[model samples]
Target: MAIKDTSETVDNKLEDKELDKTDLASVTNGAILGRDLTPEEDRRILRKANLHLLPIMAFAYLFQFLDKTALSYTAILGLREDLHLKGEEYGWASAIYYFGYLVATYPIAGVLLVRFPIAKVIAITMFIWGAILMFTALCRNAKDLLTTRFFLGMAETAIAPGLSMIVAMWYKRSEQPLRQGAWFLGNTSAGILGGLVSYGFGHLHLLWGFDDSCFHHGSNLSPRHVRDDRFLTKDGRAQAVARVETNMTGIKNDKWKREQVMEALCDPNAWLLAVAYLASIIPNNGLLTGLGFSVLKTLLINILPSVFQLVFVLISVIGSTYLPNTRLLFMALNVVVSIVGAVMVREVDPVHKWTRVMGCALGVAFTANFPMTMAMVSSNFAGFTKKTTVSAMVFIAYCAGNIIGPHLFFPSEAPGYKSGFLAVMICLAISAVLCIVLRFYLILENKKRDDAGDAIEVPLEGINLSDKTDREIPQFRYIY
Candidate 1:
């Protein structure tokens, strides 16, 4: 397919006729734009757009997560020993990144989204974080690791919100779940990817110059081979490692300034969605940061370790993406899984570990919420400004959750983080309630509009929700 610039396409359409600014308002809802195409054509447009958009957002998130989580894997490989990190220092370093993320997330959503081209903004941020990830290999201690993580968080703050804004601009309400699911699958994919990468790195530690004390291939090998081994210089090997790392730094582009991005923050719906996102995010981040440690320290010793973690990651990705009635069902299932996981953590049996893993996997179901909410906001809001504002708000909530999640990991609850599990359970339960409330609210609003004779016919034309000047089609009610 031809890669046509969307902005240029819009410009060409405008030049074809003396553009009617007023007419733009008339079709803000499904009214006029819906009328312009047949149902099949409309489906085709939305489907194609989603197919293109979701993968981009998902992959962007996948790499963003890989960079963020790399620290955890590194820590397992003597990052702490190498850097002289102390107890709770790892927790603090991990938590600090979210602080940077939280500070930047709302600002980008509220300001930069309006003034900048999202694609350019996101691409630039991605490149910056990738560079930071590569630099992390050079860190000598906790302080350096913390600083790099903070900057990494800052660079990634644009991703969830920016992608939400972009998705909103393209798809309607009914089509949101699957598209959103696709984007959220990035998180699940990250879990699987992180594990695999860590496993590879752990294995690499046994090679010629890579051996760290935690992993020694020589000790496991035949005595003759162990004695014969004469390793290369650490400094020489480190230089080669540095060179390889530097080459992995990704691309960079121009960034949008603060003022230009804030326009998306002003919408009220943005705030509502942010609140909803916060409801889910608290548990999600908490689980992600600690789950690996829990599996390694507790479960890996007793079970077929690969099967346990692999199952959790697989269930998370598949259940979230392909589950029926994704929005409500997934949230409901997450609540059950979290509660069970929390309960199982306190048990003594090996089967209990499986329960905890299942609970963790269920947490993955929350991924559906991100995409669904984005689609809802996009379809309901009119005009570029309003849409962008709400998009920013959604991300602000995402950042809030990330910040709140890690704090639940208290030192008092180490080994088996009982308190954090309970806290996450509460978060997931709250998400379920919110989903129900939003669903009913949309239903009532639709009914009221239908009664008022302002109901929009499907296959509408020219109407968009963001266009405020357009006549209110009384039937146009907000879909829950």
Candidate 2:
């Protein structure tokens, strides 16, 4: 726990022939070295980190969600008509975004995020996407819309992986779920904001276009203008690094390890998490529902699900922090709720409108599970390369699910979209089962590590802060 004592521990291990010199040499030179913080100082550092970091991330995430789902709101305001969208062209437009997302996730996450300064990379991507959002206003046809959305998808891919890594860098393993949920609230709450924005600007033609173009332009530029070290002092940065030492997940490491990438590809937990993500996102795409009502009623109705999602996400993630080893448990429960909601939406009579509206609200409850899975990635993965690689794999599955989601909503099905709803039920069920499977897998892994008599104390001696993957760190424990 003492940074000064860490050198003595390293020296003793070296003299005892217990520590490899290569491991010492491979540690990043940028690693923050400092004294152990007081409990009060730890809390103070956390508060400062949260205040400075979370708001910027949350704001950027809000705009990202808003711009991405703008097509949904705009479709209601005649985006289809404006672009002269044909039968399945609108669905293709929605699906195409993920095609770009799927294409770009690997290089950006596995390479770009690793090779560059994290904050600067995030800022540049946000600015590029914001400009793409502006160009969206100028699109005269479906082709232009698809082109812009593709690049927009590519640009916006940085936020989730980057922010998750930031959380992993700054927060403790126990603190990650709440922090991840906090920023992700931007995504859920964007529904309410998008509703209000669409309602206010729907009737106005040029103003709506201008708002989309200029608002994003202004918001995205703010990050680049801000200094990177504005919040933390020199000593505070070291304490911040010291804070997450027990996490067993190292911070930034510029040198990419090919073996780590291969390990990530072979990791059962990574594939399990990826499958859960794939299942959840397929249903997420079909959650938006509307009745044939006035704009005000439609706005109010649409806002209901966002409200539902917000409440559920808060309850689940906040609850995870207090309850030990229940992150995946809560995730499964969220998916179960969505399955029940999907059933209600599919089975309830069309005449029972309010009931179906409530069903629609419940149908999206599973959105809460996403942040938990992200929390798993942040808390569970160790090596920076493996973490980013696993994240890219999971997001690739996410993109694939999203790409397939819209196409499931056959135009012939119209308002019912029975096939899409059916797919939602199936995917939700699969996701719930996978959550339980992942939980059990982690439990078994932890048991094996314990039974093998790994040196749980070695991690305390500074080994945890090394650029070693979880597989190489026998002392590392998985958080379920």
**Residues 96-129, model 2: lDDT tens digits:** 8888888899899888888776777777777677
The model with the greatest TM-score is 2
How many pairs of residues collide in each model? 39, 0
lDDT, candidate 2, residue 92? Answer: 80
lDDT of 1 by residue, 16-62 (tens): 33223322222221122112243654454555455545666777766
Instruction: List residue ranges in candidate 1 displaced over 4 A.
Output: 1-35, 38-54, 202-272, 287-333, 346-352, 455-461, 469-475
lDDT score for residue 70 of model 1? 62
Worst ten in a row by lDDT for model 1: 244-253
Error of 1 at 305 (Å): 12
lDDT of each: 0.51, 0.77
Superposed by TM-score, candidate 1 places the C-alpha of residue 34 at a distance from the truth, in angstroms, of 6.7
